[model samples]
Target: MENFNAQFVISFLIIALGYCLKKWNILKEKDGEAMARLIFNVTLPSLIIVTFHSITIDSSLMMLVVLGFVYGIIVAILGLFIFRKEERRNKGMLGMLIPGFNIGLFAYPLVQGIWGEVGIKYFGMFDIGNAIITFGVSYLIGSYYAKEDVVLNFKHVAGKMGRSIPLMTYVIIFIINLTGLSLPGTVIDITSVISKANMPLSLLLLGIYLNFSFQKSYWKGIGRVLGIRYGVGLFFGLLGFFLLPVDDMFRYTVLIALILPMATSVLPYSVEFKYNQRFVGTAANLSILISFVLLWVIGNMIV
Candidate 1:
């Protein structure tokens, strides 16, 4: 419990520092696009490569990925049905927020801390499933909100999939492992160095992005978002906890993973789709804040 509290406090403090930096204009909105790119294109990919390269695959681990996908799909379908009566704007926000989890920015480190290297490796697999769903189903839903020319363009879809750094990194690492190739010491060292930057950089960017966009008026929607997020999280957490065949640790991890906030990527998608960007952005930031408290509570129970 003490360890969980300490780690939770440290993590929240780092995120708070990021918010303060952005609030003071030390980190501006203009910097966000580049920072996000760096995370998506470089740091996260490097971390994935390092993780996948280090871990061996197993059937049980693969089952976790399938389970995660099933959970995401279920939540997405539920959101679509439940939010049907909401305004188009709110519906769009719900669609994006429902299935999108910040697995990369937050979950990876938190899970790794709790369960060690094996947990982190499982997280990478979870992320792979997440990426596929996000790009395929979530993209379609978000695009519908954006009123994009919905067409079946396999080539365009392929190109988008090809550009995903984390996914590609996983594939490459998996192939390397399958071929029984070992990473050279120098390469491992380089990846390790770059991978270390991911958490701090990502949290800082999140803070900066929030500071530039946050408004007092947006706080009104926070309660509603939290209600939905935690409600769904608890439902799945408890359901998986009792019903799944997994052990306590795996069950706990899945529960906490579900409780994480919507991803930051949802903001741009909301903007592009003419959704209520203010609501979506504010909700995401607030959800992340709430997650810290929830993590501390859950960590105490499990750890």
Candidate 2:
């Protein structure tokens, strides 16, 4: 219990430090994008490689990936249905925010602190499918429903996924694991050093990017979005807890992930789709704060 609280406190504090730095003009928002690049391109991929390299591969492990993809689609569909009454512009943003988990940047560090590399492996596998939806499926939805006529170019989405280092790393590592091969010790050692930076860098970048501004008009949309998000969260979270065939650690991981914040990608999607940035930004911020509290409660219960 002490370990969980301590890790949560330290993680939140680092985020607070980044927020303070940004507010103080010590770190600009653009700097957060640079840190994000560092995390996604270098550290996160390294972490995935190192974690997958160390774990034995099994057919059952595929369940983790399947769970991610299936649940994401489910939640996304649910969000679309629940908010069907909203205006066209709001639908895209609402749907975009619903499905993807902020696993790499938000959930993994806390999971690692609580459950170590094994937890990472579970969440890492889950992240593979989450990445697919984030970059591919969710991107399509956002673009498709944009108030502006968006030329649906799947090639563009595919190009974005192709450019993703972490997703590619997942594929490469999975292939290697399939061959019953492990990475060279020296390679793992080198990546270990780089991968270690992922947690703090990710959380700190999230802090730097945090925004809370919102107009009065945004609250109606924001309220409906949050309501649907946690509504789905509560239902599936309980189902996973009581019904999943997985072991305790995987169950616990899934439960925590259920309540994670809206993906940071939502902000950019709002811009791309000509959705309300104020609403999206406000929802994103509130999700972070709300997810933190939910995660703390769940972490204590399960830890």
Residue runs of model 2 more than 4 Å from their true location after superposition: 147-151
Q: List, residue by residue over 44-132, the lDDT tens digit for candidate 1.
A: 88787777786777787777778667877888888778778876656666776778678888776566555655667767777667776
Location of the lowest summed lDDT over 10 successive residues in candidate 2 = 54-63
TM-score of candidate 2 on Cα atoms, chains taken together = 0.94
What does the lDDT read for residue 250 in candidate 2?
A: 75
Q: With candidate 1 superimposed using the best TM-score fit, by how many Å does residue 184's alpha carbon deviate from the native?
A: 3.3
**TM-score to native of every candidate shown:** 0.88, 0.94
Q: Write down the RMSD of all candidates, one decimal each.
A: 2.7, 1.7
Tens-digit lDDT string for candidate 2 (44-115): 998998899857766556877887888888888888898788777678877888888788899988887877
Clashing pairs in 2: none
Off by over 4 Å in 1: 87-90, 152-155, 211-226
